[model samples]
Target: MAQQQETKSEPFDEFIVDTEDCEAREQAYRARGTARPITVVGNPVLHKECRDVTEFDDELARLVDDMFASQRAAEGVGLAANQIGVDLKVFVYDCLDDEGVRHVGVVCNPVLDELPAERRMLDDSNEGCLSVPGAYASLARPDYAVVRGQDAEGKPIAVQGTGYFARCLQHETDHLYGYLYIDRLSKRERKEALKQMAEGAPRYETVAND
Candidate 1:
């Protein structure tokens, strides 16, 4: 996912997760998982909508763990399953909100909620993706957003946030739907972003599309 610069903190205090416990929880997942090479923009897996995650078994659990490892390895705040070449509706995030409060969790079969016009406050901030490697472009996204999904164990949950965390949630969801942030840009902007990627190399291992 991308690092957002439009962190206008909203008062969603009731939605805040247990950050104190998140550090230990995040480490436990990362500890049990192996980091895999991330898939780049041209990969087929990243171009199509992902399959829904039906079985909440050990395999799914392990995938979540691996996603956290992969996200950390890529130095990204959030990642979707297809980002690692898995065509499943799953994503993991370890991001901080506008207030610098850390939130960590996994969402399976995630769905973003439709925001009403009143809540559609556009935050035009620069965004970058791990899959796109070294490109970034300013995009307009609602500062406040919400998502409904299940946990690693398949329990129902809803997560909402403001600023950077909101962008993380929205970004990962878009990945599962086979839409990169560049997809939202103008043709010129999109071409510019791809050109930037062509000129740079990712620090971490990446899966070559070819």
Candidate 2:
């Protein structure tokens, strides 16, 4: 019998995990007992472009809390609303080290800004999603990017990220656009990776209608 994997704890404070230590962060995600089925690429909620968040009340706060809870429960670095079957432009991230944990925040209505041309491409990195259970794939992404959005408190903000945060931002933003980690790979790679992912994974079907 296979050894049972240990699940991560909740109320993620970012202080416990150092995101700057890529190896350690990856290990944390890997340690997550199992991958949970996140809404897939063609799911109507994922495909239907999310609307800009307009309300900021207790309800929204609760949703934000739940998003964070889900991210922690899934042991993911970032999470988007669409992945959870909600068609809304909302995402939460905590890409920092134990010392720099406060940088983590939510992005409401995220819009990508001009990334320095020199920083556009990055080496392929292993990526996974909550929606695609038990699937991990290497995906190529930019090393740096600029994102503009509003915070949970409804304040406008612009942030620039490099390294892991940049990669995560791109991935989460892709979720908002109905793209999955597999879509970032080359056609040949996607074919092979997806085949392997589907073998032991639970069945998932794309939603036919948006």
Clash count, one per candidate? 0, 2
Candidate 1: TM-score? 0.92
Q: Write the per-residue lDDT of candidate 2 for residues 36-60, one digit (tens) a residue.
A: 3356545668655687789977767
> Global lDDT of each model?
0.89, 0.64
Candidate 1 worst ten-residue window by lDDT: 1-10
Evaluate model 1: give its lDDT.
0.89
Candidate 1 lDDT tens digits, 34-89: 99999999899998999998999999999989999999999999999999999999
TM-score of each: 0.92, 0.71
lDDT (C-alpha) at residue 61 in model 2? 69
